[model samples]
Target chain A: MTTETLTPEDERRFLDEILRRELTPSRSIAALLAGVLVVLLCVYFLLETILALFRLPGWLIDPDEALNWVAGLPGTGPGPVLALGGAVLAMVGFFFLVSALMPGRRARHSLPHPVLAVVVDDEVVASALARRARLAANVSPAQVMVTVARAQVLVNVRPTSGLRVTDDAVERAVTEELDAMGLSPRPSVTVHLASTGVVGA
Target chain B: MNGTPRGLNRFITGLLGLLLLLLGLGILLVSLVPPVAQAWRDFAAPLVRGLHGAYEATPLPAGSSWLYVVVAVVLLSVILLTIRWIAGQGQGRASLLVERPDHSATDGEVTISGNVAEQLLRAALSGRGDLLGLHVVTYQYRGITALRVRLFPRKGASPQKLVQDVESLLEGLDLMVGHHTPVLVHLGAGTRAMFTREERVR
Candidate 1:
């Protein structure tokens, strides 16, 4: 293998670039929209309180009064307002649950770490982590997800006897499959040499 | 419904506005006609308020006729929850949109999909001389009417020789089964490897 190795300097620069890429536009947009919704909701509630306290004729200040006050407001029937409000509330609740529970925050930003877990047969490695490092290990990452983006897998390879877990073999197997499909950056599923079982990284 | 977040959100905001307009118009129309049956104030007013609250999904504050606390709660809850969820999913899940002509000028099109680069880069980084220095990309090019022989080097391989090899590789495939498009093999870019200029049919 006489191939010239890319200098350590090059490697460092590349890794740094990865971090910057993680803060993608999609994340920003989502955050902004969420903030706007919350603010608008709060504003509405505050106004209702003030108006009610002063006893501003609630009937005169009906939905009609609110609409005319705004610029170029469309006069839609009541149906749409109810439906949209309900849907937004429901979606928010679901989002809150999943975000709170999921452990890996890497995917939360722009770190496209597509992960797959091939669980091996033993509990030895998982048990050890639980006992020593208090790293709650799952026998499975629950489910293995293969995304279109580049995802590197962290595997616990406890291959016993005669099986040489060379990086090339593993890399080859995964890359070949991805290539034939016209996918790139071929995913590198990391292999963790372990004693008993395997889990996701 | 599958509209981008921007479009979807705007549509929603528009809906709220529409509701306001209708409410306003309804009031103006009803006020135009005299208060039906002796200005029924107390009983009917409360009922209308209740119905409007349910209809708008914005529960006006208790004993308050203004659109205040209730609107805030609904909007705030939805925004925070939605944004937080989005924050979890990472940013920009939207597909990269490319504006390309329907008909490509190049013979056959070349497309490199997601995550494929990871593998190629890994191979390039592998320090394996034989793996083409990792930056070599393989693509199929078909052009107007013909066949030619050429060879090509692997990523790190000598380009002149690679072109020759590439030609032979194509010839073996017998892609020229008919009097048709030209088959050209050449290396594409973003290649970290050093290679001579592209070699083609002599």
Candidate 2:
């Protein structure tokens, strides 16, 4: 093995690339399914063409006849079936286009580290935030809901009857937890307190 | 971590989408509009006639059509290529991690397998109830072998705490191996944690 000199900045950039690729939402399923469909289509045409070349009975239809039918499709004019099929085809195409264009990011956040690369899923952050909010607001586990998004964290709290939970308390708790975690591109925290409180303590 | 070229997948998907979009829109327009339908018919009639003329003119030794034979070959190649493309996705899992030539001996070599890191890391992290699962694998990144540790943390588990704990364990691993190996710690929510509530004290 050979040792090559790499600067600290280059090493960080390389690690960042790996982490980003790992966290990106995979499009392998879409690619695989589309490839299979294409292969099947090609197989169908190949079989028909081979049957025609061999002068045998067409498995489904002769290649020459299929070509003629496609060429004659425009002569048939607009019909409900034709219009519906066209619409469906367009929709499928549009879906694929969107999937390809979108970045398709997963709900994960990478933390800054000197040598070790670290990534944490949003669900874990949400859970931790919810737990902290529940503790700070003096509410039950079910009374607090924390939703973590790409750039924001929404913490909703339902206080017990006769117990007032301040918005500042929940906000400060969530902020403190976020500070402890030190996630990159730190998410803005939003605390929503329900007007109506739960009945039992 | 497995090697899956996401950019290539997106490109192929985009190309396929663009082709289908054009073909479908062309069909829709030609069917809905009378003028377009007439134009298409005029455009396709000559092409179809020419195709038929060529098909008839080209014949194989066995009295079969050479045009269809050519078409069959092209389609077969397309199918084979597509299958190959699909098979190439998500590969490059490394089974061996390290190899060092022993200078003291004439022909001695030292090798380390990926399973050594996997089992050691798994045993180190197995005591934590907050983690739903743990997976450690080694992959060749650039020219160096690196360890990828995937931690499936239970709901309400603090990922920061988990990361810190794993870092310490990795330090121990570094001492055992006599050198530091690059590591990536991923704290993820696996399907079990997503669908089920696993916390007991919460």
Candidate 3:
């Protein structure tokens, strides 16, 4: 049996690769709605077909009646009505097809690496930056709000009275921490110091 | 992350969408153009008459109608079941089995449960005041086993410190397991209130 051993660098690279790969969100809501609609339609058709076959009162089950309805639809009075119905059907179909084919977008940011790629979630980055900002400003976690976007990180800090908090220091600290993270396509950091301070110990 | 829609769903959606689009376009075109409308009516008359004649000729017997109803119900049930199976493609067990890298017949296979990993993580994170909650889920991606560590930090907790502690614990787990399992840490805010002041009524 041949065994392969990974060096430290190899292990680090593997870990980095694992961190880079993100799970794609499954648009279950759309799929579930579509599935439910299809099931409901099938159930309705089943009931109608069964009722009609049993010589009972049923709506829109007879093939002959359906064909007649189709044959009569073209000559139905208003041209605008027919056109509008057709347009609605076409638009619904178009949107359904597009959603079925499209993939879910990943809410992650890629970090720069020489031999390895790393991707971090936007929320995770925001939490980390918020923690840093809170520490740098010496404020409670509730006082600091961090928002991490594709190309920017916004930090809003609310300091208490008699406490001196420098926006530049907090901004520099957050920026340095982000830089140390080595995120690819690093986003610009903006720090905002709110004028009003909350009354609390 | 949830997996994308399966091939069967995509195929079904495409087929249904195309059918609807074509039918709608055909109806709109026939309604707008008089010549097309005339042509369609002329073509549909014979087909409609044939259908009507067929329906008239095939008069269902009193008791035999029940058989047809049963058949229709069964067919519809099958179709609905198929659609449900296709839609439920991604939800499966997230745990992965641990196997030795060496292709040795003498060595046996080992299975690692996600529950066990979670317990291990819980033990590692015990006594941390800043942590609100920790959850560990195992996922297999492209044949690699990964442990997704979800962390909820208490209010005012330093995320960097928490991450460092989790990283060290992961390293320790790797050493103990005799196999390297990469950890993916997801940090989020704690849902619990940090401090609740009690009202003092005189």
Candidate 4:
């Protein structure tokens, strides 16, 4: 009988590897939105065409009228109408092209590790870091704001009155904590201390 | 983490984008050039006239009420299917089966339910002072079962320490289950804490 035991190092390595695969942005939301829009438009046009075929009362759209509108474009000899239509088309095309190319949203980050894979969500990272900053600054949790980005972690500290919170101290604390996590492609840490301190317990 | 969009979705979006870009450019060019516009109009005139003529001449036959019904049913079916496809676009597999390394012909495979995994995680991690809330969900990743652990941390909790504790808990879970499963830890801010604190201070 063979049994498998994963040491802490093995677990760490596994997490590191998985993180890389799981952290990248997904295009699912964009795809779903686009798919629904296209389907609705197709259904609308198909319904209209079918209604026109049946000579229904609600079939206000005339194929002849649409065709005539297109046919009449040349008679007007390149006016604002054609330009506006072209511009609208161009805008729509640009939107689609950008959506196709743009990375939708950064929801998670893959930690750097050679053997193990691990992915952590940005929100989780932010929350965790916020707690760390709050403790280090000796400020209320609400006074600390943490933003976790792909390449950077921004910590904004609003110190309470009578508490002297230095940027270097907060920065060092955050840096050490982040370093201990052993994040791959480690993001740089930025600590900002607001000048005005909030009055709170 | 959510998986990437399906291949078909990306392809369709790319195709639509390319088509729209080309159509827009062509329209812009035609609008700018009088000669090109004239050519386009001349080319489109007969097609437009033919389409209108066809529409006028092809009214449904007087006694073909059944034909309308058939067409309506087919169209409705197509619409329904399209809607269903759209709704299911990004859904991922919910459960994963634990693979058996050595099995006789009669041995059966073990199935891991996502909800069960969530319950196990909650049972293991709940009541920790550092954690405000815990949610566990399972998703298929790269053809294998993976768990996503979303944690809302208590204010002033050390992020590094919280992560270490979570890792240890997961290790214990893996040992108990007899198979190692990938786990994703998501740390999120405690919304309730943030809002309540703000209201109190105000």
Candidate 5:
């Protein structure tokens, strides 16, 4: 309708922003952990300082004593404790660094549409592929398994004892289904038929 | 689609990581090397002494130290700020979907609540067993109101069919509203979809 007034550039920008946010994983976990940690640290110091103002002993030690202990850590603290604490801190830092650097993409793919923007999760795609493959091979749902990866789809089928199922039929059906979906960066399809068929129907 | 400050989150995480990395490595180094330990002692001794001096000199009413009051206030503010930041995540859901001001009209304004779109779409898309659940949420993106329709597809449900069905429904909404509203259709397989057994009519 009135969306026709959107220029190509505007549409592209709109889709780009939406897709960028939709595909990337949110950093809520990291933020929450960091925020909680900071809050805890601040609370500890606040309590310690308040206690020291009235000349009361801190839960662990006096505020001044705690500082002296920390200041003395690099020089006189036990070697093993320093090493362990340092290693743990370094590992935590590396974890945060990795989380920030990685794109953290979710399992999703976008489909081309004339007017509407659509994205489907890879799990959903796998389920659809499994259905198609099972129907094409004339097998029960339990006999077929589908795994959808970032760039490939694998369909495994176990034919019934008396019936014969060809890989070509399953592959063709899966490919046609994928074509109909028109997912961007279309994943390649692989069909595998088990040599040993199940006994009975 | 919701307003989450992802970039800032990443930045804060990275900064925390760098700080921790340096602190860890510094401790590890100081503990393992005599020269580093000696250097740290030399640097810290003066700072420790200076802090002690400050604590003794600064006295407020009731024998409480001004230095302690200042430190406590600073830590309290830091805790407050962090709590505020943690509470601000995942906000920005718009209740008003559309609002237009027309000076020439008697009413001079046209408004549509977000509930209208959500109800209309939900009513139109209901009774589809292929979808385990559906949610319509409105968000403000770049000063324009946009809609995100999240569909939980049952196992073995065709996403292609789902996309086409939603597109036609959106077209219906556009005709009713007399203006185009941008929409993002997301079809996902949640736990409900995973646990749903396929129903077959024999």
Candidate 6:
């Protein structure tokens, strides 16, 4: 609810440095499944109607008749068989989609890499900033599990904290850290600002 | 739309019953036509009677593989029951999805103070659309610093639309900054925000 005025360039620079987590297998599956389902549903209904108009099912003799027609394959008609195969494939695809999706990772389960975290002197505010960054990164407080020692800060992030989100602000925080060292002697802060590495492998 | 599972089952059942009734009526209506009607009168009820008799007179007993038969039946039934469930899951969680990920922005907008302000300001500028002109309402001057962000509605946007957009953006930001892992990072924090502003120049 506060307003800290910003210059255009700092925002740009920080955005440039931002990183994002990748999609979880589960969520990606769920989303793709949903899209696929929509498409399949439409195609299925349309094709069913078209097939009916052509009387394809009727033209294909019953299994008993088909066997009598030529080679004896019981209860099989090419048109109907193709339709059955398509249906089975659709079902399998749907199953795989649901199985692979992980809603947790897709929904609310990503955090910035702990690598971005730094250990600062106990008196330094960098430690606190890192803590907030962890929180602001939505690293579950339980997951972050912060600790402090003699002039030191430690952070532990959960593995599920990967997947893309709006990382602009977090990157901004990093840019701020880079600038804090005054972008001086080789920009140690900015160089280190790219700590947005993956966590827990 | 937010019906409970039990309620949904009941609704679907009722819908199916209504559909069956309509279908039956439609068949009866068709049977009333001249040629179709004549045929229906001669055979429809008789066929129905035949179906009733044929239904139980022939038991589909599997030879020695009755256990396999039972298992197959059970599996089929389970698949039938769960099929709709799987289909429903595939249904939208849909509509529009906005993604904002930073936890800092979760409070609205991220504010910066002291030396970090300039860097943070740069990142904020990278925002798209209405995201551009975010005002960090406060910054840490001295002592303990806190960050807050204000989200603005896009031009002609509704409150619902704006909230959804902002929340999703936050979600996206959170995803972008964090890593994929089980054990957490940012562990062991030592400072709490003290009410006293170390330096409040404005």
Compare the candidates by lDDT and give the number of the best one. Answer: 5
Please compute and give the TM-score of the first chain of candidate 1 against the native first chain: 0.30
Where is model 3 more than 4 Å wrong at Cα?
Answer: A1-23, A52-56, A59-61, A74-95, A101-103, A110-121, A134-143, A157-167, A192-201, B1-87, B94-96, B99-112, B140-146, B155-161, B188-202
Among all windows of ten consecutive residues in candidate 3 chain A, which has the lowest summed lDDT? A110-119
Per-model CA lDDT versus the true structure = 0.34, 0.81, 0.67, 0.66, 0.83, 0.34
Complex DockQ per candidate: 0.03, 0.63, 0.32, 0.36, 0.58, 0.02
Candidate 6 per-residue lDDT, tens place, B1-202, comes to 1111322333333343344344444343433334544554455556545644653454444332223244445544544554554454322221111222346634553332322332444364465342224433222221112222333323211222233444444444436533211111111112322222221121
- Candidate 6 is graded, for docking, as incorrect
lDDT of 3 by residue, A44-127 (tens): 777777777766766755644666777766766789898888887787677667766777456677554342223456766786
DockQ of 1: 0.03
Clashes of each: 45, 0, 2, 18, 0, 84
TM-score of each: 0.23, 0.93, 0.68, 0.73, 0.90, 0.21
Question: TM-score of the candidate numbered 6?
Answer: 0.21
DockQ of 2: 0.63
Interface RMSD of 6: 21.2
RMSD of each: 20.1, 2.3, 6.6, 6.0, 3.1, 22.6
Please identify model 4 stretches exceeding 4 Å from their true place: A1-21, A51-58, A74-86, A104-107, A112-117, A134-144, A157-165, A193-201, B1-4, B21-36, B49-85, B95-112, B196-202
The TM-score that candidate 5 achieves is: 0.90
- Candidate 1 lDDT, A1-201, residue by residue in tens: 011223445433433333333222223343445456556655565565455545565533544456333221222455446445445554554453333333322221121212100111112112211121111122232221222223443444343334345435544543443343222233454444455433323
Q: Could you tell me which residue pairs clash in candidate 2?
A: none
Residue range A1-201, candidate 2, lDDT tens digits:
622334667767777878887678768888997898799889888777777777888887877777887888765544666767777888778878888999888888888777888888888889878888988999888899998888899998889989988999889988998999998879999999999999986
Q: What share of the true interface contacts does candidate 6 keep?
A: 0.00
lDDT, residue A24, model 5: 82
Worst 10 residues of 4 chain B by lDDT: B193-202
CA error at residue A167 for candidate 6, angstroms: 33
State which candidate has the highest TM-score.
Answer: 2
Q: lDDT per residue, candidate 5, A2-41, as tens digits? A: 0123565776678668877887887989989988988988
Q: Find the 10 residues in a row with the least total lDDT in model 2 chain A.
A: A1-10
